[model samples]
Target: MPATDPILPATNGVIRRSGCAADTVAEAGAVSLDVLAARRARSLPPGVRYELKGVAFTLPPVRALPVDLPESAGGDTAELLRLVLGEEMIGRMAAAGFTLGDFELVCEDWRRRNGLADGTAPLLPAAVRPGGSR
Candidate 1:
């Protein structure tokens, strides 16, 4: 069946488990929080300290779609996480005294949400499955 039937209710779902982190002291490739805290000690606020926390990514349970096609029913939760996280990372960094200059929020948001090698727009709104739609 053609995907354009509009039989399926377009939705946005949370992505399943996957995540990555980068720190200020991040090496040529990757850096950990401990290293970041140490390297940026002088610049960091006096009361600030390094804290490591993990974020879990998980696929939301499969949802039933009005459409008959299996593909149309499945929501890409992982991709959503990526999109949210990427945008969140920028905000997080800003709060941490860093800026996401030249980083395309849309691109990062898209790639993370879709798990694409390159960023892409979300086919559905992010809040739809979270009990809201916009």
Candidate 2:
């Protein structure tokens, strides 16, 4: 299956078992939370210390903003946003000024409108199925 394919409801069970959905999403453009946190730390002002078990750690003095990850970190910015914020949460974020769009939903809607089966590739002229021509 293509990485961009929408995870259909019927396949949810298999996905839950295999745990490959997360991997697929990551491959599509999800960034590790660790990497994001580190990037945020670097943007903070110097000399900022956070108390943890009475140990002072000098780091950036600024609070991390809920900004979208950079494109370089994730090949597809929208996919990264979806992965990080999740579908529903992302809608709330979008209302708050984030420019990210729900690309997957859009694709799904398009597929349905075109009468294509969920997760099925679009028909191509001269294309043949594994067993025979369609």
Candidate 3:
């Protein structure tokens, strides 16, 4: 990826804000929900989709990683890893000896990469604000 490009490029294509791949349209890379919360930025635009290996998956515009959740929260490890770090990232981290406990560090790296400050905060869905219920 170019230093000027804010989005991360995948082997198949670009991962959109919605986590969908667009063969033609280049998109800004996925943003961490924590980063958005830290900056008080608005959520990503709606209706975005991600494509991988010619298959598309509908996802939220802002891809929030579950880096803050405790392991006891319970879910598929690989799926959780994918949600937060993306496929390529998970692979790289795994190759480098990443563990579940390192999720916070990954989140911190993501925040710093996006030029956001390092901090802890709950990642609420777009429909649910910090103090509001879904």
Top model number, TM-score: 3
lDDT of 3 by residue, 1-134 (tens): 56455654554433245643333323456433553464443453343344333344343322344334423223333344365445775566666666666655444444444444444332444345444456
lDDT of 2 by residue, 1-134 (tens): 67455755543222342532331224434543554466658755444333333332232211332332322223343354245445575455455554323345444544454455674544332233233356
Off by over 4 Å in 3: 1-82, 86-92, 99-105, 115-117, 125-134
Better by TM-score, candidate 3 or 1: 3
Q: In terms of TM-score, which candidate is stronger, 1 or 2? A: 2
Q: Estimate each model's TM-score.
A: 0.20, 0.21, 0.25
Give candidate 1 regions above 4 Å deviation. 1-92, 102-113, 117-119, 125-134
Q: Ranking under lDDT, best-scoring first?
A: 3, 2, 1
lDDT of each: 0.37, 0.41, 0.44
lDDT string for model 1 (1-134, tens) is: 77554864532222122342333433444434564454545443232122223322232212211222222324443334334445565455446553333234433443444344453333445555444456
